[model samples]
Target: MLRLIIKKEIQSALRDTRIQFAGTFLILLMLVSVLVGRQGQKQIQKERAEAQATMYDKWVNQGAKHPHSAAHYGQFAFKPKPVLSFLDLGLDNYTGVSVFLEAHKQNEVLYSAAQEGNGMTRFGELTAALVLQVLLPLLIIFLTFNIFSREREEGTLKLIHGQGISMRKLLMGKVWGTYALVLLIFIPVICLAYFLLDQASAGFDPHVGVKFMGLLASYSLYLLIFVLLSVIISAFSKSSSFSLLSLLGLWIAACIILPKATTNLADKVYPTPSQYEFRKTIAEKVENGIDGHNPSDARLADLKKQVLDEYNVSKTEDLPVNWRGIAMQAGEEYTDQVYDHEFSKVENIFKKQNRVSEWAGFINPYLAIRNLSMAFSGTDFHHHVAFVKAAENYRRAFVKKMNKDMEVNDKPGTEDYRVDKEMWESIESFSYEAPDIGKIISVQWRSVTALVFWLVALFTLASIYAPKISRL
Candidate 1:
């Protein structure tokens, strides 16, 4: 009986021109969006590769130079585009891609893609992920919001109901049937996009298949719960127009209004410092120690005393190694400590801000999916932080190597100490690998828990509400 009801629903829905035209138009639009996203991804990957190779070549081939000068010359670290980023851009557009690494200073990632665009770019780019996450739900609403109300108004539901069918069985069939129809268009589009991304990345992400399957599962649950919500609304509506207006209101609240509201509210609750103020705060703390003088000099004086004591010597000339190099390293160590303390406070502020949106997932599944999508794509804050810290560590190691080399080879007070190109070439270039998927999932467990709650609630509501249709 369930199978028969499902078959009847599919046959009737296919007969409607609105359903046919919508499915065809959306499928075509999805294909175009996929092509656009693929081309954009390919171009970025190529550019990053070329720039990284060029920078490494320049650094290795640099002629003989003073060790300190080479530290000042620095190098650029180009972040590679994650293989799965093409599927869902996430925060990639918002965050910077390249970092300038140098001694005595920590640099922020520079050159975000969004900064180059016009005013309209703030609204967002239309990728295939956007089409599925935003537009396809509207398509689902259009097809299902009138499912029961139209039949009730046309007197078909009365005839069917009089044929000894309970509303539960009817609602069950409608939910399953509508889901099947959505899958007809939805499944193919995902498979097509995944295939294109897989080939486009040339197998960079061996876990691409796993990631796509996870996406498939998320969308499947999202569509099922959404259709059930629409059907329950249709069952309660007096007419088709009312059902649509109600569904649209729900969609707007879920997709559009709540996102902006939550973000603004989070900002109000946990504001971030302005750029100038943040930097100024750090600088002030470093400068005004017991006396308003160079904190680096104070730190260097203490470092020289320690080195002299360690070597059991009272005079600089008696020490076998150069105290100047060691003093410079100690200065940077103190500066790094100051930056680390201040930066951690800033990081804590940002974490509090994000917690607002993370918990908002319980109220809005769209927020849940958005966070989860970005995290899995390696474009979220966690991924960005990992890359940045990795670069900083590499910079520290490189600078320390250069300092130690100078201390061993150059005499104290020698201002023109230079190292051969072989020493410079010994420094390894930076490389970054995206964090493991398990780590990303662990960080986003709040969203996963929220999605589970939504699924269970929708199924429970379907069972409870479908039987309440005791009126016309």
Candidate 2:
């Protein structure tokens, strides 16, 4: 009986031109988004690869110079777009793609894509995730908003109930049948997306497949929540027009209004410092250390005296190691401490701001899915922070290597000491591995919990109230 009802629902939906047109339009939009996204991804990868290679070439080919000088003429760490970014660009547009790593200074990432775009970018891009998260729910609303209301309008509600069919089974059949139609449209689009992804990469990683499947499952559940809600609304509504209007209003609130309002509220609640203030704070903290450029600074003089006393020598020239190199490294280490302290404060503020939205997921599934999509795609703020930490660590190691070489290899009296190209080539190239799927899930537990809660709550609400449809 359930199978018969489900079949009847599908047959009736197939005869409706509205379902046919909406499904076709959705499929075409998804395919177009994938194509445009793949092109953009390829362009980004190409530009970043070329720029990185060019930067490395310049670094390696830079002529012999003082090790400390070479440290100031530092390298760039360009972030590679993740394989899944083609589906969900996420923060990639706002988060800068690279950082300039130099000695005694911790630079912020610069040159975000958003900075180069026109006003249209403010509206957001048409990525596959956007299509699935926002538009797909609209499609679901269209299909199921009148599932029960239309039966009542046509006086078939009495006939169907009198035929020994339970309202629970009837509701279940309609929900599953609507979902089956959605799958017919969705499955092909996902398969096409996979094909595009596979073709874009030289060899796709198996872990990417895992992330893809995770995305598939997440989006499926997200859509199911909407489907169940629409059905429930239709069951309770007096007429098809009321069901449609109520669902559309809910959609506008959940998809459009809530996300923007949440972001604004979060920013107001946990505002971060401006760039000037942040940099000023770091500079103030660093001034307490020895001045590397001014050898005669009081802190440097004190350090010279301390070192000479330790070595039992009258002057720095008479000491075993070059005093200038020691002083430079000490300054570097002190600046590092200051940078770490200041950067931590900023990171904490960012986390606090994000928490506002993470907790908001309970009220809006769109927020939950938006966060989860970005997390899985490796385009979240966490991933950006990870890249930053990696780049800074590499810069510290590179600068330390140069300072160590100056301390050990340069003669004590040789003030103009310089190193060959071999020294430059010795520094390891920077590399970054994105956080694993496990770490992403751990970080996104709030969103995950919200999704689970919505799913269960909606199911329970439907089961309890769906049977009461007969009284209406």
Candidate 3:
């Protein structure tokens, strides 16, 4: 009986010219977005690779210079683009792609793709994630808003109800029918995306397969939640138009208003200090004797004196090791301590920002699904932080290597010390390996759980009250 009802719903929906047109429009949009996203991804990947190669070449070809001086001339760390970032772009478009590592300072990553254009970027670019998260729900609403109310207005509900059919079966059939329609519109696009990604990245890890499949599963659940919620709204509303307006209000709150509001509220509650203020604070503390920035100060003078005495050297110059290099390395370690504290504070601020949005998942299933999708794709905040941390790690290693080289090869008070450019060529370049999809899934368990809770709550409401819908 449910199969028969579902078939009937499909046939009736197909006969509507509006449904036909909408289906065609969605397919076209998905195809266009896929092509555009793929091309952009290729271009970005090519450019970043070329930039990294050029920087490496420049450093290797640099004239002989003091190892310490070479540290001051530091190199650039270009973040590699994740293969699947083409589909969603996620925060890649908003975040910087490269960071400069130099002596005594940690530069903020530069070149945000979103900031490339004028104010128009605030509207956001077209991407698969945007379509799935923002536009697809509206399409589901359009297809399902009239599912029950239209039948009631036309006296079909009375006729059908008199046929001894339970409202539970009827609504279940309607929801399933609408879900089938959404799949028809979505499945082809997903398959096409997988094919393109496979063809483009020859060395793409198989684990990305898991991430992509999880993305599909999460999106499907999201669409199902929308379809069921719309049907319930239709069952309770007096007319089709009211069902639509109510669903639209819900969509607006979920997709547009709530995410932004929560971010703003979180910033207000746990404010992050400006970079300038943070640096100034560190500098002041260093000047006051703690000297986390420069370890060659009075606070560490005792340690230096001990080392000199142990070596039976009257001054730093008489020591066997290059004291300047040691001092520079010691200074770097101190600065690292200060940076660790500041970066932790910044991370705390971001966590607070995300917590507000995380709790919002209970009120908005779309938020839950969107976050889950990004998390699985390894394109969320966690992945971004991983990249930044990896880059910083590479920077520290490079600096320490230079310092160690200087200590071995340089004589004290001899400014004529220099290392061959070949030494720079010998150093390994930074390479990042993205975390496993399984780990990503583990980290986002809360979001998945929240979405399941939403499904359960909505299904319960529909089951208990759908029968009473006639009382309205």
The number of the candidate with the highest lDDT is 2
lDDT of each: 0.80, 0.85, 0.81
Error of 2 at 218 (Å): 1.0
Model 1 residue runs over 4 Å out of place are 202-206, 288-295, 413-415
- What C-alpha lDDT, on a 0 to 100 scale, does residue 468 get in candidate 1? 88
Q: Write one digit per residue (lDDT tens) for candidate 3, span 127-241.
A: 7888888888888889888889999988898988889899998999999988888888898889889898778763534567778888888888888888899999998999999
lDDT of 2 by residue, 245-332 (tens): 9999999999999999999999998999999999987787677532334333666778888998999999878988877679888888
Ranking by lDDT: 2, 3, 1
Query: What local lDDT score does residue 88 receive in model 1, on the 0 to 100 scale?
Result: 78
TM-score of each: 0.94, 0.94, 0.95
Superior by lDDT: candidate 1 or candidate 2: 2
lDDT of 1 by residue, 74-103 (tens): 888988887767667888887888998887
Give the C-alpha miss distance for residue 304 in model 3, angstroms: 1.3
lDDT for model 1, please.
Answer: 0.80
Candidates in order: C-alpha RMSD to true structure: 2.3, 2.8, 2.1
Tell me the lDDT of candidate 3.
Answer: 0.81
Looking at model 3, residue 135 earns an lDDT score of 87
> Candidate 3 regions off by >4 Å?
202-206, 289-296, 413-415
Weakest ten-residue segment in model 1 by summed lDDT: 288-297
